[model samples]
Target: MVTLRLKGLHRVKAKGRIYWYAWRGGPRLTGAPGSPEFLASYNEAVANRQSSDSGRFRSLIALYRASADYKKLAESTRRNWGPWLDRIAGHFGELRIAQFDRSDKIRPVIRRWRAAYAETPRSADYGMQVLSRVLSYAVDPLGKISSNPCEGIKQVYSSSRSEIVWTDSDIAHLKKTCSAEIAQAVDLAAHTGLRVGDLIRLSWSHVGEDAMIITTGKSRHQREAIIPLYQGLRDILGRIPKRSPVILTSSKKRPWTVNGLASSFSDAKKIAWPKGDDLHFHDLRGTAATKFYVSGLTEREIAEIMAWEEEHVARIIRRYVGRQAAIKERIQKLNEARKS
Candidate 1:
């Protein structure tokens, strides 16, 4: 008898019957060990696994990861995109580049994959965005595909938060109910109009006599955000003890992580509001924009300070200041009628 050694050949015994496989959980092999049919199946499976196009999605993803375009994305953006890229690769790794070029054929398949996370519309949209970016890269620099199938796909989630501004009462309640750290965090965010990530990363060194000038984190230090130091902001800053290099620290006197601060804020919100707690930390940006409008800052100035579009600044003003003007006019009319 002769013994034959085979790579990636797996054998299983079940119910008193022996079965051969190319590998565990891989295609089943036909015929006896060393038989022509068995060898053929094993060779075919191994060849498929070794083919360049077997992991075409992964290969494209690798090229994109190394490309200058992907490298230029903000650090936080890249971090958020990492998992979605992995999911795309996992779902489509075995596909050929030619298949992606057939937009009609591939679009339905991509949609089906996206539909799996339909319950999480935001997440699904994010995944779609990542997939679209990858496919766009393939279309342009790689030339592996003719067009992006994800182009012009309607996003499932839509929201309008223009009217959502944090009230003074909401701030007072948060300050009263939450810890000193969280309270200071809220005040800093309300005054500076910084995003949560930027807020946590703000340092005392960024503060100057007239204004706090620092390049925004989201801009990858390419654009500067200039926040004026008003009396209210000065008062808030004067009260906070600098325990770390960063202005806002955890209860442990360490720099705040984004998730840590968000979790803390969420718990504080639950305790303070208990119900009807629709306000978010991001709403502080809108509140600060409203404050800027009231302080006589032009729409352009406010937009520059907050790195927002002028149209967005105008919308905030309309929602808050315009409404106030309407209410004041109504009251004046009522008072005049009473006097008559």
Candidate 2:
């Protein structure tokens, strides 16, 4: 029979095999070495192979090592999945991959995450999505698991409460209250529905004499977005230095972080706009869409210009198209008067 020993530790031996029992007294295995029965058999085979000088133990070690899934995931995907993977690793504490029942293993984690983020359900939902993506890679690419544990988990509910649209008076108040530069950024965002990311990344090269082409950052699917240089927006762009690529950068010429922009915007609003009329930077996008709808642009046309789904046109039309028909009638009357 094979003798088993550890440095200041104990081991079990049976049927000419030896094994170092797990120190924590949990299971007879450590770190995904296959099933408990498989581990036992592997130990016996190792002892036999050592006595016979066979390659059986070496081949089994290679096969078990090959079963690890983390190697197959892409670098970018691994970076994105890192936090979730670390959490899972921390909770399990070196458990065997084969020992886990996908649902039973992850459901409790999800439950705890949900409870923690009860007030902000979106955070919980995002956590689940991150976990699901990692599990998908583990099951599909790594082949460590036959099925993804993330499958069929009910997606956490989130609210989509619509934000109030900024009014003309609000815009005027903001312009009057903010510094010339901050007011320009506010005005440009109001005129174009470009995201804050796209807004900050904009370079002088993107802005020609007649129009501005924003390299969109949201989906990065649209390639580039085209916005006409209206007279007011052109005047703002003119005020910015010709050499600076970013239109709204700080003195260091670096792009604004979301928090940085939000803080600047908050300070600007507090000084310029009246109380109780405060709005977010995103509200400018809504205001821009509202203006476009009221300016005789069709819903389909607005969707194209704004990169919004066509389904949103109805709600936008309802919100902004009020009183526009009267304005159109007045314009028609003015044209008839000129003709007469």
Candidate 3:
């Protein structure tokens, strides 16, 4: 037997199995050691780590990508940030990290790069956010920068979705026109107020006699969102067949991936409301909040259930419930006038 040692090749043992990685905390290498497939993967990972613009933003970005800080981020967040990181690298890769110490010098440049995506304000803002995270990592962990220039940069996109709850008409039309999967998704979202990611991951095990309990996917604190088992939610759950451990399944009876669910929902939206006002799957959160408010839940109680700020819950009630309450009052007045 021959022992082969390769530079930067790391080996580890865990749970009675040995594993090989390209480098410590780097990408895992597959195939038997010394095999062609293993060598190829190792080489690719090493090649990616070599930065042509060393000591510059490109190198910093590379280091950030490999750091636990980046890896520990939510999978969806990492996926969303990947492209923006590339864009930041392309734009500022050659700029020396020392240059970022001066906020005035780097802030304007970042803003200018952000302006390129102004037509899509949300994308523009997201790009800024991703860039900021990388730079923040550099400042704290790497000590490459004196300060983060992205601080206090005003986001170009401002949105108030208080009025965006799905109406009964919209839900009815969606149920009639969309596929069963999409209809169930909408119903589950409206009733439980779970984000799409959480909704897709919901299972029968999470349901209790009085409430559904699960850790929210996007919560930084991994907080458990406890939603009471309302009749509407129970009815929606009763109608769904237990094809998989996950409550929501695709048309093929497999668990729903985020992209899979979004693509299908987008198509369903077009067919179901071709001429109607815009509605998003996320709006169902507001719908659920409204329902909770109308059912006599206080803002603080709804906030706890939804894992949202109490202020945000209040805003949802003021927008949705306030209008409904006013309408009910007007109808009562109309009936009284008719009697007079």
Clashes (backbone N, CA, C under 3 Å), per candidate, total 0, 2, 0
| True lDDT of residue 162, candidate 2 | 39
Greater TM-score among 1 and 2 belongs to 1
Kindly list the per-residue Cα lDDT of model 2 for residues 75-179, writing each as its tens digit: 334344445543443444234555334578766755775567667777667667765654565566556667766677775673332345667787787777676
Question: lDDT of candidate 2?
Answer: 0.59
Question: What TM-score does each of the candidates earn?
Answer: 0.67, 0.51, 0.68
lDDT of each: 0.80, 0.59, 0.82
- State the lDDT of candidate 1 residue by residue for 129-194, as single tens digits: 998999999999777888898887888777556567787888997888899999999998888888
Candidate closer to the true structure by TM-score (higher is better), 1 or 3: 3
How many backbone collisions does model 3 have? 0
Which has the higher lDDT value, candidate number 1 or candidate number 2?
A: 1
TM-score of 1: 0.67
Ranking by lDDT: 3, 1, 2
